[model samples]
Target: MRIVADTGRCVGAGQCVLTAPDIFDQDEDEGTVVLRTAQVSGDALERVRQAVHICPSQALSLCED
Candidate 1:
């Protein structure tokens, strides 16, 4: 799977970062959701899915690649 982050839709809620620090992070300057990587699998995929669902601004999503 692949992660897709809509940075413009992010509100700096930090939910994604908290949910999956390995896959997501907050930019220091903007505090927006910064994707650590686009591809995900194994244990990381689960956390990424949770992050996408919990993102307050609906800024995160996943797609099959």
Candidate 2:
């Protein structure tokens, strides 16, 4: 799967970072979602999904590659 983070739609709720720090982060200055990597697999997939679901702004999406 591929992870997509839309900074334009991000509200800096930080739920993504809190749920999956390995795959997501926050920009220090803007407080926007920063994607550590777009690629995801294995055990990390579930975590990434949780992050996507918890995103209040619905800025995160997972696409099948």
Candidate 3:
């Protein structure tokens, strides 16, 4: 699985950060979503998916490869 964030759509609400801090981060200056990992553990994948769902701007997506 891979994670992708549409930088153009990110408003940096930090929902992804709250859901998966290991994989997502907030940019201090821009307040935007920062993807720390393209691939995550199987256990972490579900949480990442939840993060994608909770993003108010829908900037996050989980791609199964």
Q: Better model by TM-score, 1 or 3?
A: 1
Where is model 3 more than 4 Å wrong at Cα? Answer: none
Residue 28's lDDT within candidate 2 is 98
List the RMSD of every prediction in angstroms: 0.7, 0.6, 0.9
Best by TM-score: 2
Candidate 2 clashes between residue pairs 3 or more apart in a chain or in different chains: none
Query: Which stretches in model 2 have alpha-carbon errors above 4 Å?
Result: none
- Which residue ranges in model 1 land beyond 4 Å of their true spot? none
Task: Write candidate 1's Cα lDDT for 26-48 as tens digits.
Answer: 89999998888899999999999
Give lDDT tens digits, candidate 3, residues 1-65. 88989989998899999998999999999999988888976789889989988999999887777
> Which candidate number has the best lDDT?
2
TM-score of 3: 0.93
**Which has the higher lDDT value, candidate number 1 or candidate number 3?**
1
Q: Model 2, poorest ten-residue lDDT window?
A: 16-25
TM-scores of all predicted structures? 0.95, 0.95, 0.93
Give the Cα lDDT of each candidate.
0.90, 0.93, 0.90
Candidate 1 global TM-score: 0.95
